[model samples]
Target: MSGVAPGASAKGTAARTANESAPVDDAEVVRDSRPARRGPGGPMGGMGMPTEKPLDMRGTLRRLLGDMREHRLELAVSVLLGVASVVLAVVGPKILGNATNIVFAAVISREIPAGITQEQAIEGLRAQGQDRLADMLTQVTFTPGEGLDTHALAVTLGWALLVYLGAWLFGWLQARLTAIVVQHTMFRMRARVEDKLTRVPLSYVDRQSRGDVLSRVTNDVDNLSMTLNQTLSQLVTSVLTVVGVLVMMFWISPLLAVIALVTVPLTVGVTSMIAKRSQPQFIRQWRTTGELNGHIEEIYTGHALVKVFGQTDTAQRVFDERNDELYNSSFRAQFISGTIQPAMAFIANLNYVVVAVVGGLRVASGQMSLGDVQAFIQYSRQFTQPITQIASMMNMLQSGAASAERVYGLLDAEEQEPDPEPAVRLDEVAGRVEFADVDFSYDPRNPLIEGLSLVAEPGQTVAIVGPTGAGKTTLVNLIMRFYEVQAGAITLDGVDTRAMTRADLRGSVGMVLQDAWLFEGTIEQNIVYPIATSPGAPVTPEQRERMLRAAQATHVDSFVRSLPEGYETVITGEGGSLSTGERQLVTIARAFVADPPILILDEATSSVDTRTEVLVQKAMNALRVGRTSFVIAHRLSTITGADVIVVMEHGSIVEQGSHEELLAAGGAYARLYASQFAAAAIED
Candidate 1:
């Protein structure tokens, strides 16, 4: 029902009217917001793009590789292909050099020294110990008068064809191996993330921004996959290529090889410098991206508030500023990263010129053959190619390292202490709960509850009432073992809760939170979620009937019946399609379906209207039969019928007795009841 504000509409109208009156000013306003490019090959486009922050890259890669290690065969195959690719790429130039030399020698012998017979030339070449006789005799040239040697040319063509096939085959294998490693790694990482999210203390989530967590699960993992699948594989190939080329270069000419190797340290130095500087930027960029997503989510979720305040322009401006910051950060990261390619290429070309000039002199001075010079030049080129690639892939390495660090950061987080021993499942648990001298605090510096003590006998309905932030929610959290108490023990039927497995403890206690989150699925799915928690549970007709009765008791069945799909009706995420009251009823029905021995209803009907509250109360009463129930209620009237009402203040029990006794005490409970009832009476 929410829409844009009237003030925003008026402002927009005024702007339009002004623009109509003077279009020139409006046009200038638009132009200022757009990025400007100054000259040809300006820094704005390709040069100054911000480098990606390194945080996400390291974190993401570490997480991905950790998972990738799970599929050893795929990773092993990927590595093997990578090594083979490097070897083949290095071998290509050598083969080409040999072919070019054979052709050159044949031409020089027959034509350069005129009237040199083919037979005399062959004998002279062998006498000079330049015995390329076998290769030269078999070689064929593409001359204007003579047609191509269909046989010798075919041999050359066949070798060339094989090289091409090897390249393609290795390339294909590298791609497949990289894909499998990335896919399986991401799958495992996703599962681990989800599992950790569920098991961690709720307080941990409370301390973090939801957007940040969501970003880790989505953007961070995706970036990891990209870096791993694309960058990591190439990085491996580049390293092997560099090694292969270096070895070939040494074999060709050790002196020229040393000259080529001189550029190695400089290239590595520059690459390392850029990588070090760019990592932080990539981390910052991803952080900003997470912040931007959070802002967008906040705006959309609170669209009604935005309209109410008539602050659409203000919000939009804020969003634009954040978005621009991201763009600038990204630009800087990418610019630095992109520079690596051209920088390495420049150094490589410099090396190439040095190798060519020095080798040519050696050949002309009779110190080396033309064939040796040619081969040296080819090896030099090959050497630089991988160096350039490695320099380029350094950016990817940075990105992957960043992602790996982030993933490891999460993995390194200390989980809550696991239960000391395996749990023993009891066929039936008496619903008695006891809190003995319990002391707890969300933050150690600020204690919420100190020396709190309480007990609920089996089949008793105990209600807790207190002002906001008086440790009401903390009590529920402790009961569920979401947070361990700093001192004292919480027991169920005289057995310490901590002694039992968290899963077993939680499975025995059913909770209906104030805000219920339903996933994007059918109504039936939500009800059946409890039983499916086990590995082998089946959804039978009787289970469905029980769930339906539970819903009907809470009056949710009526709404389901009115819907187009009844029990099969699909709900949007977080139950957005359902009304708040309906969502509450659904949660109540879910708890009923769970049918645990101990029930905790934390503000179960606080947000519902009178009719819905009454319906929920009835359903709760039915469900509470013969079970220990802890009800934390804001509305005093709802808990008036409870067997005991315990008043709390600042984490301590102030009063406890039957509601009637507390009302007669004319203390905190009486004052709370009077204030609320007085407000309702005034409205009436």
Candidate 2:
């Protein structure tokens, strides 16, 4: 969620233009890489961002295999089934060839029933200048008074049917097991990526393109799932089919086997050449997809301001540009990878032709039986078939590898520092927060805060005020430990914050920022937030009571009761159903429900209207009566009654005291108050 409302930056720009005094609220922002035409895409860090490349495909694949180690047993079974299926499939053609041999031998022997020997018939054919027919007859076994052996042929055909049946059964089983293994592996991969998201530092997250990160998680992982499905299911089976067919071919006839092997080098060469060209395109296709997603996300989220600025046409044109890039890259990748299968098929057909002619000559010379020649021809077809199937898998494999590389890049990203071992725990937090000798900078080359020291005693309200980019919000961020200190320590109840797990530390605090968040859910559900969303967990009576009490205190109950659904009325995350002031009120109510020991409000009322701001001030006054509260406000009037008002300039505390005392001293705080009220006076 943005820390500022839509158009807040524009408001900031206007404020700057008018008074030359707009506070730089530099926190994290969703970025667009391209130069801005009018709105979001404008001049963000300058120029088009460079796309990512897959530097080490082999290492990435190895890491992917490591993730699948848990499912190795199922994968092993799948591979064995694939092998069995291919072996049975290869043997089926050979078995059917036997029936052909039996029928031929029986037909030749029909002449025996006429009281003519096989030699006499063949010699008469040769004498009649039918040398080819006589030569073919020599390869067939002729038995006197024997016709075609129908019984033997029936048995041979039955065995062939059984062989094919086994092939189908094994293939189906392999497919099922492969699916299981792939789903399980994807499950683990997603889990790892999810965990990594939580462990990465805020700085790391801020520097990344949000759309790119999301694409890796959603699109890339989905693509990986499909790739694994194609690869795991067919790769082993195709390879084994080729090997088994080759063995059977050599067993039948070495010459024919050698002729079939000629296509191997050509197949390998074509596949390799195509793969090299397509791999980079596939990588670019996915990267461009991420950039497009990022652009859409950025534009869509800021669409409200886009319309306010009349930037719809510009936004659509930019979207078209991104979409066109994706389309071009996708087309090139598909077109290149698509050539492999047809090329392999052509090479295989060439080998098939050569084998058919040689096998026919061998049968005529009496060197090979007609049945053997038939089986060898079938073997040549099977040989190229497996090779073709494997070639067909190349596109999916490369696409999947590109997806894997991106996902693994996310998984391998640097994580946040580990919490200190033997951590110190606060048995009871009295909410005494302190910063000592703190030094920090978002960019180390340019220091923002140095030697900052402050203490918030129990139940004291400290209001931090500063000029734009003067580190007002940065102060509270440090207190929350969102950014770690470079040279000092921050303590909560006398224990270093670094010693506590982030969850534990964050659980003690409730923060309401300037830009409020309301998710897609009922008003009551959003107030309860994460507690309401946890799986299978019911909201407690106490939580419900807190929700009701807070809604009343923040004056949210008034508007809610006016609606037909009351608390049950659903609102989108965009807060379309509620006004800006109402949205801010809902987030304030959420803070009230958290009931944390410590509260940090970063310009929480900046987005509210005058009437709503009064109601919020009343609610905040009541909420902070006995809590250690740190309020960072740009408005001077809001902090007039604070127990301590700290005035800062260029990251250093210039003046700090009660409001009246600062005005009496005529220091930095006094001038700030005068300038703010003076601006108000001029407007009046």
Candidate 3:
């Protein structure tokens, strides 16, 4: 069990412990190991963060937009609303300028004295070739010392206020619609990524840290979603605002418009340069964050082992190194991206100054009115405002793109090859398993098993005994189809295993590995998981009875009944609450309840104490009565009663017979058996 427990090494166990403990929200651990945040250019570190490679920005953006195609209608509507909103906003200053012009014109008009007749004032206006003004004044009642047309001014101001109010209302609507669209898009993206994870091969999972994978699913997706929601709407609005303002500025005064437009290229150039430089830093920052997360996950999981091995100091040092790297990368990325806003602001301010000065000159020269000059300055500000917004949004977009690239990379990873079509399914398997002329290797360059062949007749106990790394578990892995044979076929009841779907193949066999895996659920739920979740007909009362009997057979019922909740006890943290031996018993019971025609027990009792092993062996013997069983054991005593004992050495069978026959032959099995007893004697 020491050798076979997944990642059972001192360091590996420690890491697994930390990882398992992570979901529990251990505040003390988090606070102590919390990543240092040194502002913009430091590590944006968190648990389960992922490191990513440099991405092709164009490709990522194209793919991200392609993903948004399903929501194109919503996106289009949002953009249209944003455009309308910005256009309305752009038209506001001009309307207000008209109101100002009205007031200015009214103030300059001559005052009508108390004695002056309305017809006389109208005749005076007509004498100055102001026929339109004279006609408009004919309806007005002249009052003493009334210098301005107050009613006309009030009406113009009211119209300007209504236009501004309309712009605000449209802008608000645009924001609400954009939120809905972005949220829906994010939902689809998250769902797709999650579905992708289910299809990805275990090989890929084996190569990645659980934390890193989780980071991609949670943190990366969140980053993409948040940035999309914030930046996408702003992106649309900013662009339309810039364009609309530019058009209005040109209409007002093309000379001033051209001057304002000059600052745009400079702003863009500065932004592009900073973005390009910051991009690599952002990439590195995210990567380091992942590394840091991976480290933290490992350290926290293995904290128990760290204490056992007195490695706390060593672990801390490793963490600090990763944290510092994350900090440096984060600092650089943030500092560079941060410069975009200020740099853009400076250029925008400079443009505003130039427009204000130039418009003042134009107004003085009689080339433009005071109202037109004021409106032009406002348009210039509006135009530069969008450019600055776009620059700021670009920074967020770049970060989002980096995150999207990582997520897409995960989505694009190779999936498990599709199951063969028209695959065979067995309703009832006789369990006569055979491995014929199998050749395999974890790495092609270094072969682990070559030309391996084995057979187990129905209801027979076939015991496989070998020293460590003699391809014991590897053989079972092949039978289970966790890996496919490289050169030959593994068959069940004379039919090729590959001819059947993996689900069908695995469903016919029950496996109890060295390390017991229990999820966060009740003991009863874990025990009956297989039957409950099976795609076949729902579990019957008979099956429930069988489950209870199996638990009793495995002695799991003994300790379970002692607990206050009995089988109803909720197991958490991968069954950390249970003792190692107790967990093993539960797994055995689970396998017994599964009750497949075939059974493969790989070091099932290797980790338990002597007393627990005795109970487990007894349970296994009872369970094996009518099933073809493959027992991979290191302890010679466990396999002594088997009908056939196969001794393997260096991936090949060296001896095969019953225990008595093998002992009489004095072969590899005899030597292995003798050595075990010798070690036992020495320990005693």
**Top TM-score: which candidate number?**
2
What TM-score, to 2 decimals, does candidate 1 have? 0.82
Whole-model lDDT per candidate: 0.70, 0.78, 0.75
Encode model 1's per-residue lDDT on 448-559: one tens digit a residue. 6789999999989999998765777667768877678889999998888888887777778877766665556777767666765432245678778887877877677888
Residue-pair clashes per prediction, in order, are: 39, 6, 16
Structural similarity to truth (TM-score) of each candidate: 0.82, 0.90, 0.84
Deviation in angstroms for 222 in model 2? 0.4
Clash total of candidate 1: 39
Question: What are the root-mean-square deviations of the candidates from the true structure over C-alphas?
Answer: 11.7, 5.0, 8.1
Order of quality (lDDT):
2, 3, 1
Clashing pairs in 2: 23-468, 24-468, 24-469, 36-41, 36-42, 36-43
Name the runs in model 2 displaced over 4 angstroms.
1-55, 110-131, 138-145, 533-542, 680-684
Per-residue alpha-carbon lDDT of model 2 for 447-505, expressed as tens digits? Answer: 77889888888889999987776777677666756568898889998888998876677
The TM-score-based order of candidates, best leading, equals: 2, 3, 1
